[model samples]
Target: MTYFPKLLTICILACILGATTFFYVKKSVYIFDTNYFKINSVSRAALKETGSKQCKNCSEGVPNLIIQYGVGRTATTLQFQILCLMMAFLHEDEINDVGCYYNRRNLVKKYNVIKCHDISWYLTVKWSKWVFMTSNHALLSRRLNYMRGKIKDKNTTIPFIADIDLVSRRGHYIVHEYQRFFGISDEKMQHIVEYLRYWDVLRVCCGMQMSADWRNHLAPKAKYKQHHSYHSPTYPACEMYNISQVEHLLVNTYVFKKLSHIGSLRDVIGKTSTVDGILNGSYCERCNTNISKMHLKFNQNCA
Candidate 1:
């Protein structure tokens, strides 16, 4: 009789702990169903974290088709809204594609206008990006473990936008926006940030995918440049990066974009003249002086 009472007490404590954790996750984290998530066709009510149909198999190919952006201050809100609206263009199958596929469209609407999508669609994209990134079994398992099945899918793509935002500092702004849009308490917002940072969806490295740093390790410097296009809009900004030690391109995007402006380029281009000369000629040399003027001259000669 004495042993039975002790066993019953232990069982009751275990049940209480389990119940507490279940409810905690239920209130804390949310995951979305990327399969049905589209930015354009949104029903905010559909995005509840019901704990059913949460895990699915990821696509087999490498995720080489992701649309990356640094999310600048001037363009942060506008870019997010634009991408959310653009999600409507994504095919159902593409939602879970490891290649991170999504369609792009013209920025036709007035950016300043407040539409329902500004909030709902923004959250939808956030969830979708994370879902695609976590398509892998191990990473998906890790994500589920972290969220504790309390994840909110928003049934749209809210987690996705938040996932990409995790890869950059600008993600802070997006989190704040989420709080304002949803009336999330400050404590809840901070809790969400902690969870996203701890799991790090952006840094979910795998054999099929690695960042520019790993690529440099495996391939020659020249090959790395060629593979990623040194002419990328963010190229000039990347030039200042200590590529020898850099690990994550997604992480560096916002850093370089913020650090290297026209004025900053002037210092860089001028210093190049003192060395072997990266530009070979005066194109980048005078880049700081008049990029538009030099660009026109080069284009005219080519024509």
Candidate 2:
């Protein structure tokens, strides 16, 4: 009777352990499968989009829309957070002022009031370092000059000007250093630079130049409509350039060669498509095109 009890206890303990292990493993597998499936759907969509040559004007050739960076006076963190959130919600091609905060009323009234998160590590690290480094002003100036020089080489029609604030002592130093490094001595150019500097300082110190201000400056009030659909705009369309013009620019300009490094929405689509295919055994039309012969050809010769 004692041995019987012991055996019963052992059997019960084994059953419990086995049940626990099975449940744990099952949950983990389910989670993994869910994520895998989502990724596959996104991937397939991207591949299909790439293959279909749909939105060809935006895809194959187009200049990135003009991106305006806004610097606010107060609520720096909030502004950064909002900008990142907007990036997440909005299409990459949509040209709007980022890196600044807007009045809640103004956001609702004047622009599309979409919720965005902070996604500006580039500004936080790269731009902020150049702005804040007191001792490395000269180095910063040299770097800005080099960047401008490269821009000049790429597009002679576009005027290359480094805008810095004149009101703040730090801003003045940055402008002086930049001018010295770049050998920019033209009186008109200097004045324009000074004006840009004034605007930036006013933006940061006075809180006058917020996102709303930028919206008024760049886009028409009527054009600021909220989009309910999930379509993300491409660079050319977002920039408001004619599709043909964007295509020509993309063909001529070699600047965006680095886009291949950063994984885009296409990657997401591809993953989603693959997962869906595996699970359903049904080929999605979009996913099919992505893996099609024509798509393979484009992928090989995307350059």
Q: Top lDDT: which candidate number?
A: 1
TM-scores for all candidates: the values are 0.22, 0.19
> Candidate 1: TM-score?
0.22
**Cα RMSDs of all predictions?**
20.1, 25.2
The models' CA-based lDDT, in order, is: 0.30, 0.29
Indicate the worst ten consecutive residues by lDDT in candidate 2.
Answer: 126-135
lDDT of 2: 0.29
Instruction: State the displacement of the C-alpha of residue 74, model 1, in Å, after optimal TM-score superposition.
Output: 15
